[model samples]
Target: MSETITVSGVVATPPELRRSSAGVPITSFRLAAGQRRYDRATNTWVDNGTNWYRVSAFRALAQNGIASLRKGDRVLVSGKLKVRDWDNGVKSGTDVDIEADAMGHDLRWGTSRFARPEAPASPRSNVEDAWAPEDDAAGGEVTDAAPEAAGPSADPGRDAWAVPGDPILADGEPASSPEEPTQADVPF
Candidate 1:
């Protein structure tokens, strides 16, 4: 079972926004959370090692992250905790990763104003509408700029993620409008 965890940390790097091969939005960054201990002899807080984690967010959260977060900012992140084992020729170790469900600036250090992202014109459109691409100044219209594919092997050939009105099968007919989900759609 995956465990949910929350950690407040300083942003160690700039947020990088990229798209998966299936056209899903994603963002990732390094977070550094430190610890301090009071020393009786010195009567001062002693430095303790800092724990580092890589945090990743998907879809709307990913978009919001690009707009809201920056390097060195104190932020709160809560999500599923994943511990991964890794090995190189010389050594092996575990790395911590958080698949963030929610993230925002920590208000304790400073104040922030909340602004709701603009609503999409229609529900039928995808969330990509929330982050529109910039238009070229030369007046040439460019549509369907493919998003960055997910991994090293991701390529145009593998991009078959379905969008609204896309054909569900290879029969070449457009799909009908999506309907509300029912109990069967729930994996649980």
Candidate 2:
């Protein structure tokens, strides 16, 4: 039986990334969660013990993990835990593995940056504004020579994240800046 678990620990080994014959990606790494205890006798903290886990991430998580994780970096992983007994001619033991569903750096120890991928193109042919007038009556040819005439939206291709009050918000990208994606934008 497998149960969901969340664990935070240091990466014990550098993540190994591999792809299956079918081209699916997978990244695996070892995690070490150490225990600390306060020693009243010595007036200091002491190392208690450590627990290790085998973590495996698939798909985009695997790609990200390979790019981001390094040995000794602190991270939090949430996944389904599976304990399996394995026997070798020399020895036999139980291995604890976590098939990671979500994982990220532990910000308590350090900081991390996030970069979101651009949305994939949809089937519907539409980049122009839906409500924009079909016909341009006001001499509507945007030229590089006269960017000011087009108002604050000088470049209409890349300003979805423009600030609400910024001059660039005149009439180009969406009014509201979305951090990630919305269900409506996805064509499925």
Candidate 3:
């Protein structure tokens, strides 16, 4: 059976990073999701109960998540759900755990801007002629000129190519009429 699940919620606490017995890095945190609805009889907002999940990340993902996330940060987590059952002599309890495949901040709450760690050292080559200068009127240095306007001759012989009863194509094809096409005649 597939046990994979995805959960999107707010980080309930800062991620705690640790190493496994085999010395692999891991980070764990809790996520809380809540829903609200209006009660018809009460005419007030009602809590639809909150879902909490334990989330874990591994290696580089764990390191990044621990460094980037903080308490109350909204995030989307995708992974498999693992049920952990433990008995401490007297009673056994079960909890939901998520082995996170991917985790990232939910941008709807706020905006995050990232800057390049370092600027490239190499000089940029003028691969396009867009910046090449044109000769100035005084001939001292090159400069850009205003773009020229289209002339009457620009459309020379264009209209002559049209044929009578050829149904003048609007722009490229025949103009669409006001009538809506029926389902059978409609192109998918």
Better of 1 and 2 by TM-score: 2
TM-score of each candidate structure, all chains considered together: 0.64, 0.64, 0.56
lDDT against true structure, model 2: 0.78
lDDT by residue for model 1 over 121-179, one digit each (tens)? Answer: 66656555644333334343433323243334334343433343334422322356567
- Per-residue lDDT of candidate 2, residues 1-188 (tens digit): 69999999999998999999999899999999999999999999999999999999997789888988999999999999999999998999989999999999998998776654333354554443222322333434322233344457656444233333444443564457658878997897
lDDT of 3 by residue, 1-188 (tens): 22888777999988999999998899999999877899999999999999888999997679778878899998989998888788999999888889999988887777554221222244655333223223223334432221122233323222322232335331223445577789999888
Q: List the residue pairs that clash in candidate 2.
A: none
By summed lDDT, which 10 consecutive residues of candidate 3 come out lowest? 142-151
lDDT of 1 at 173: 29
- Candidate 3, pairs of clashing residues: none
Off by over 4 Å in 3: 114-188
Off by over 4 Å in 2: 118-162, 165-188
Model 1, position 119: C-alpha lDDT score: 61
